[model samples]
Target: MAELKEARVPDIGDDKDVPVIELLVQPGDTVKKDQGLVTLESDKATMEVPAPFDGIVRELKVKIGDELSEGSVVALIEPAAAAPAGDAKPVAPPPQPSPASGGGSEVAAKAAIPATPAPATAAPTAAVVETPTRSPPVAFDADALMPGKVPHASPAVRLFARELGVDLAQLSGSARAGRITKEDVQAFVKAALAGGGAPRASGGGGGLDLIPWPKVDFAKFGAIESKPLSRIQKLSGANLARNWAMIPHVTQHDDADITEMEAFRKKGEENKDTKVTPLVFLIKAVVAALKKYPNFNASLDGDNLVLKQYFHIGIAVDTPDGLVVPVIRDADRKGLLELAKELGEISAKARDKKLSSADMQGGCFSISSLGGIGGTGFTPIINAPEVAILGVSRSAMKPVWNGKEFAPRLVLPMSLSYDHRVIDGAAAARFTAYLAQVLGDLRRLLL
Candidate 1:
């Protein structure tokens, strides 16, 4: 003989009049001791009412959205097989499993319980077996959630994240007890769309169901030889890919009249042993421009902007292996002649593979010069952690109208690439204009 029992809601704090958000089982379904029978949601959290003993569900006492309270009868359960008529005494329900130790065993025990689950109570696709409840409504500890490490959020919040296709694990919740909220999900979605941090749950395709890159047999076309990429190329290539993919890049193109600066630079190149390149003067001007517009020399740290006080400019040097930016520390402190000498030494070291890791660290801004090679203009990727980069193109004599008459002047084309998250378009334009002014009249650099 089987004894009949009711699965009543357990002691869930002071919360009352909570609603049944999900019903896990119905009449005729078999459940194990401590298996979740109904999912209840309070304003603050979500939890499930568990079966008190292994039994067959006889009748549902409540429906979805019904208000519930502690000790409220949820379902009528028929106890497991009886031992003759006496049955020794009524067997105690299985002990509640500790979240850490019994996560795996809980699955096994629930599996043993017959699962003739009724139609999905939550959604047509929603599974309603022994409800895989992650945490009880009162259990604010995120670790108590179900499965192996799903981020801690309420059932409703989890559903919200799923609808937005945002992964909860990637987000650090702002709510108390590290609880993820609907607002957190919305913010993450916005950030992903803006190209700042963490990607969408759809494999970061930016909502595109893109096809994989095709693989081809190159030797089939003609004779071919394959060579492995150098270590620097491989490393920098990955960083470039990540930066371009995650950072919203915007480039502002402008021309600088470096005529006077060029004349001064050529005068110093007459020395065979010591050569002063245009880059030395440009470096000095860049430092001054940074002082004028501090935002240009800042990085995006989460929601805050980190403004750097010191100017450690990075110079992008092209080598046979790949492109590497060796930083010049304290550029504000070094004079034009000293900068030229240091640049020469570092360029030589970079070419010979003699530059140490220390020689390439701690940069506030970066400059990539394609002037020597030849290009009207080009966009340089911001060397990350540094907000902006200046790309210097070839200098040409372009005729400019000096109010009254057109005069030919040596014009240097430069493009400023910056992380749009930190510096706006207007600010970037101003920074470039100031740089061009300082370069045209090297005297302004003194200010």
Candidate 2:
């Protein structure tokens, strides 16, 4: 009789109570040795717990949303006997996060170095003759993927097309049974380029003035596969593109000394009615700053500047689908605990795909916090209609000279990106400085 084996979470460096984001296997599934059982996501990385040996899963020890750490049991397995010598190896290498890619599966990560474009070669006659009439490129359409009418292609091929911004509906596949492949997409792009079908510059009606996006056959260099962008990605991609192109953005960088505040937060963490997070404090501090600098809380509407009296703050939540900013209404009226509770609820709703349009609209300012995720600083894009957005990165202890001698201080990095048309550099600098001051002393929020 095969002995029962426990599949436990391996050493997941320094991450405690990481949430189980996905389950890769079921209790009844027959899993190979080293096959992933469950996926855990921490602030720094996402990793999967693997089966210790080839086995039939008897029971899952953990479920989604369960907090797990190193040595935490994931599943119970009944080990399988040794395989025959002539059998092919069934062990799959564990997926490792690609250092170069911001965040995605290993298969989604494109080559770090650009694969040299396949030399100019004569295309298959069908590929050249079947090119679809290229539409005049304008702003990226959020619904351009045309979910209503999908093309005949593998998920990997579809993903490749999406990455290249190639509309699959238009392409004619040369493959068997009218199936579109990566090669087909590549050929369509080459034909479009050779035919001078590149999109016209934004604000310029003249068509085909810009160089077409590059077409490359990644398979020539090495192994490759594609992963489709989430639905949120499709929508957000178009909006982000429009915002980046239309807005004249300026970023102001500053640091906040939060040594005392951090200490206070930790001390109060155990006593808070609803768990108080750094983000709760940020929301309060931002409200205070907005009150002092009311212009930052206003939006530009055609020729008018609409100043909002009620404080609604948009918190950029990183959901598995994509990034969604849900508004916390009347943030000025809510206490820290209330804000914290609401933040938690809204974030949960975002991740669960439960947020409505109203949940995202009517924001005076937006905050994108990457503090939980490790980052020194990043210029966050200003969510449109909101004139400014605050980006918070991970805090670190650093030596700071306090009048006489250097003292170790916890410093939080902030990047404030503002619409240059609405906010001047001096005002932007002043706004950040005041925000930092408020964050340094949470007491300032009371005033």
Q: What are the clash counts of all predictions, listed in order?
A: 2, 0
What tens-digit string does per-residue lDDT give for candidate 2 at 256-369?
998888898898889757788998999999999899999999998867999989999999999888999999999999998889889999999999999999999999999999
Question: How many clashing pairs does model 1 include?
Answer: 2
- lDDT against the true structure, per candidate, is 0.78, 0.76
TM-score of each model, in listed order: 0.60, 0.54
Report RMSD for candidate 2: 25.6
Query: Number of the top candidate by lDDT?
Result: 1
Clash pairs (backbone) in predicted model 2? none
TM-score of 2: 0.54
Task: For candidate 1, write residues 1-447 as lDDT tens digits.
Answer: 466788899999999999997777767665667767788888777887899986677789999889999999999887754322122122223334454444233433432222333354543113323454353244244342232335656678876765565667677889987878899888877776566765534444543323455789998999998999999999899789768866889999999998899888888777777788888888999999999889888887778889998999999999999999898999999887788889999999999999899999989999999989999998899888888999999999989999999999999999999988888899999999988999999889776
